[model samples]
Target: MTDATTTTAEAETAARPWLDASLPVAERVELLLAEMTVEEKAGLLFQTMITMGEDGELAEADPVFGLPSNREFVLEKGMTHFNLLGVAPTAGAIARWHNKLQELAASTRLGIPVTISTDPRHSFTENPGAAMLAGPFSQWPDALGLAATRDAALVERFGDIARQEYTAVGIRVALHPQVDLATEPRWSRVLQTFGEDAELSGELGAAYIRGFQNGDAFGAESVSTMVKHFPGGGPQKDGEDPHFAYGREQVYPGGQFELHLKPFAAAFDAGVRQVMPYYGMPVDTEYEEVGFGFNKSVLTGLLRERFEFDGIVCTDWGLVNDAAIFGQPFPARAWGVEHLTPLERVEKILDAGADQFGGEACPELVLELVAQGRVDEQRLDVSVRRLLREKFALGLFENPFVDAEAADAIVGSAEFRAAGDAAQRASIAVLSNRDAVLPFTPGVKLYVEGIAPEVAAAYGEVVDSPADADLAVLRLQAPFEQRATMFENFFHAGSLEFSGDVVAHVAEVAAAVPTVVDVFLDRPAILGPVVEAASAVAGNWGASAAALLDVLSGAAPAGGRLPFDIPSSMAAVEASRPDVPFDTADPLFRFGHGLTL
Candidate 1:
């Protein structure tokens, strides 16, 4: 161990006496608050990931940066609150790293334990394309799948399981329970959100918060839930996402923006501690024409004033410049306010009443803003006070260390795995079964395509491909953002029309056998041809694929309604007003429209 680690361990051991709960909460908070410096308090607001190097050790950097490197600078300068990055190979290693970091924080006069936060990690597929992998955490289905099951109890159970896994690894804050309704199917981030229904989404979202925080009322292990995208993030223009430059506008023609806010209201009522504004700019609303990260009218006026929310507000990533990843320099999120410099953006973010700057690793800009007297020190003090109070409320000061031995025992345990499987089974939706084409009788040779071979074999003799199947099972995906020459940025500028060859292939398979089509409606695509050719059609948001299969096999019943209208064509999507989502002149499938046995 390094000198910093040794010193920190000694300090942690020594400071245990002062962490007693017998003291009043105010007294403890006051004592801890008095010990922190401006620099140290500022450090608490900045979170960065600590990555493991290629040689299997923590990478070193300049301590002046207060990141993972520059060990001496970190110890001397006193930075706390790290977003533990890159999963470790073993729980023991994670525990060790966390303990060492806490020890370092404790060595400082205030000894405020670093409160580590994490995005969702316990999902079945790690979603490397979107979120971090579940290498060390317990694996569960994605949020869309959780929403499909329509079971509030299951949602809570999943939260409870994730809380156990997170707490075991010393992650006190969960930066999730996205709560945003997936109204716009084409949004790349839809897989992470709950389905498009406002009421159902709100109830389930609240249950998620309650589960993570638990009813402990005053326990340290109770995870702090960060309900995100304050108002909502479901009304992207033309089914485009906010991540890209062109897709930054969120429209609201159907008056569905208010519907989207319902779930967030539910999250707030549940006592969630943090709120994250989306990167999308709302064009139709009275709020500023910029993304919610920079819009004070939305963040301060609407979320804080109207909703009466009093939680910490953090901006989405890429809001400020000065950090580079992969050799590419990212600009500050000056989405609507194009003229603001990086420093100006920081001032605006603070003035808009946001508490923390997310996706930003550099704190020098913040420090510079403070030093220049551009941002009031009292403003910083208010946010820091709330942050520290949350840490105490989470019991981080009392028990900063995690029980390493319990880590493996709880993560992916048989019980948790069983719950995940049950959730998966429940979430699948069976949309259509014309003429009772489903529940194939036993001994019938079944021909399947596009589904996993293992999954297909469960039904009957699985065929080699579409041509040889007794019943053609075609799996489909919603139209994705297309790239030019496989090198350009994926911009949403394409039609939902499938390639002629793809349509031809499906038609050919339909001609050869009785066909059943299943679409993973991550986005609502024009399915006129498939719906015309196939004997039956099924559609679902995220995890509905497996559920549809189960329903077809008579293992389960189909019971999901379309959360948003399936537009008849791309023309309808483009011609519709920019503000309202699912506001097409005419829809192929209306919202809440579904079929069953």
Candidate 2:
């Protein structure tokens, strides 16, 4: 090494001290924080949804969510963080799009690289707000199915695999492993949770964090996890979601507030990097009645002081402002503080000690608060420090671009897909197998509903009708009453009991021939009538037709236990408290009930 080259490198390091990898993370964060202007600092406080453009180009606009162009979000808003909404047709396309975004950020004054995050993209659930279907990614079962397997090691392995896939496409953060206990069987988001048990959720949640964060440390290879809906988002009143206005109240009728905090405690133990509080306001609790995002008693007192957590706390989407989604306009989820204006809501959220606003792109509000002397610049720096430190710890400042050519080979590779397929098969819970009705003999005539003919033919002959077949196989989804709004309909929140029409149809098919029924148990369904009608009944979270057939044909073991109790009737569900687990009397299938067949 020549002295001239060494001197030039040293001078370059002095020009951008934050770029020097040898410095401590804290020192790097402070150095970057000092260099950022107020607009850039304000941008760090808002992380909203960003979409990919056509042909891996920069998106000019998004009419669906009314989001501005990527250029405006980066240049005008001075933003460097985003929650990637959708994926491209191919992994390489997504990687190219990510690189284009980084190139735009590089053109900025400070050149702070963008940090990309995403919701659970390896699942079948397509609730745009929650999870996306595994398009061009490895397909796996929902979180509830992972709980049914009761294998922390398997869960951890899934996380590690997911981390690798996410990083390949330039995603630095994972917005999931929703650890909320599914105490309320009727709740719409139950499928995303671990289960109704605190200890089990805590154990699995910690393992998930370990897998994503690369074994309890955040580094270049790690994908930072934002363990969320903190203080628990389950136990909604009447099993409705907090996403809509009618479902805003989160009741603790059983007075079990502390129990809901168990999984988050496990998350904290596993060294989670970020937290997102739910939109529901507490009812009859010691804390304020306002939403968790604006509740200082819970965010500051409980999380910060009592738990001594110093991670970045981000609010759930659309707390301070609301906009049109799916062509329908929605109001802000202010909950108990609905009377306050958007500006006032911002003030309360910042005062509550939240670091960022999820699903919001408004840094101008923070600028307004700063100019009016309502918010101290020093207060903003506290969160800016944490936010910048994460970008440094993630190694985003050094190399934000992914190798676009390598993404296609790495993501959804044959090995990774096989692991996901095995998980899908293992997660199928055989709730009932009367007289060894399963292990269906090969070449038996079979009538199928949801199973595609080509996939079913591998196990048995596929018949068009149940009457012409030797046996019948039906795939059904758990029942949920339809809501008025299009967005609300996605949330499957209503009666767990099967409707009269569905029960009669199942009985008709079973009466025609010996039947095997598989119900997609997003929520715990009342399966008593179906159990009586069918020769065999199974529960699956998310599995392909081939995976389900493999378990039924004795090729693979039915390796899942029930993640939550299935109520006997709607009356039992109505009688049980929302916050109490296993409170329903004489549940048809108790938690952990599954057959070995």
Candidate 3:
């Protein structure tokens, strides 16, 4: 009888050495590989995204990001890996959902537990396509703000907190700690990076990797980190993001190609288990001017040979398939090889030394390619070995389930929230405290904008306008030029200057009272006009008004410095090249600029 038709008694006595955890992980992996069918081996190559319904069940709603229901993707498709999108309401809800998902995996013939990964979920960013909301997770500042504090210890501390929460909810892979340096300040995605300093980015990135991996290596307690945008993604042409066709080229006009490679080396040294290459094609480089996902020279030669990295390399999402997301059509980011067919794209990606494909659920194409005598099954095994090694390293063969009951108590505990709040306060940078107008006396009437009246009233009286208050407080987000698509708008990009109307409004507040200005510098905003208009100015990446008030009122001190230089004007930023760091002439605020009250 075939394996599928075997009885329970026959299956139990099958002599599966892979089921033995006491044996070496490599030997177990080898034994398991020998018994797998071609279809089973192909399942491990796909890592598509999955979403949950409001009731914490498998979502059967209309397609999101052009994806089908989880049942089809997980059970019928034989897929074992998923990047979790959207968050559950409670910690226990996520835990329960994860348990149910794992139950589905357990019923499969091989019983390979599904591995769930997620983008950064502990930050203030709520871009549905890019980052998940920090609901029930301790919300901290974005990566740039962490870099502003310039404390590797603090970054590690945040990572530790993130690890606790992730493990509680059964998240096993962190698809983040984006090590791409913010060399191009105008790039839309800079807000998520660690800033423009290569050395600082490298230092903090290694510390972050250590925290997720649960100290020097991957184990049952560890969450594997996928340090992303390999070879760096910060040098986009004219600061345009590579997710769109218009932003497809990554130019090196400043000729600093080696500078971008620094942080990846640091991540590799830190024993990062996975690497993700970006979508943009490198222009004027020695290698082929193809997208980094298809650049064999970059992946095989530079990463594998020169850097000596022996880890799983996955491509960024949707590089080999054309699909629609949120009703807008998106073409595959086959930048240099746009002329190739979908099958050819897959062939090229596999040949380029990548182990897995992101945002793709097609393995039949590969099965067909192998059947055609074009691609070898042994070549496919190379990636399967790396993938299986991670699963074994994570102890999925033993127990892949989490304590659904303990998830609530462990995730988003009161102590974790308090620490996250303190981090928000500490990341506030006092850029200018002219005449010590801050630290306003308690019980004074205050008029606030963009802050809750009750929150502001806790410190002082809340009034209607600047004319009726002791000091006018204003909170403003960094500015961005509008884009065509709704999804593009989520990524803040373009001009750093405030609009004429915004400048006039802040000036009116400054004229009426001693206005205290707080700018949320997701990316550095040109602050020349705002500084001249306000009596006092402070900068924060992302913080609640209470946290900012605690720092402004001297209950806590603002210790953060400029992680990156703030350009003096749009003219300066436009004049700078895309590949260079801190190249803006005469910055308004230089890197490492911060003051104390």
Best by lDDT: 2
TM-score of each: 0.87, 0.98, 0.97
- Across 285-368, the per-residue lDDT of candidate 3 in tens digits comes to 898999999999999999999998878888999988898877888899999999998888989999999998898999888888
The digit string of per-residue lDDT tens for model 1 on 232-346 reads: 8777786666666667788887766677788888887888888989888888677789879888898889888998877788787668775444344445556887688888888
The alpha-carbon RMSD values of the candidates against the true structure, listed in the order shown, are 4.5, 1.4, 3.2
True-structure lDDT of candidate 2: 0.90
Q: Distance from true position, residue 297, model 2, in Å? A: 0.5
Most accurate candidate by TM-score? 2
Steric clashes per prediction = 15, 0, 0
On lDDT, the stronger of 2 and 3 is 2
Ranking by TM-score: 2, 3, 1
Tens-place lDDT digits, model 2, residues 500-540:
99999999998999899999999999899999989999999
Clash pairs (backbone) in predicted model 2: none
lDDT of 3: 0.87
lDDT comparison, 1 vs 3, better candidate: 3
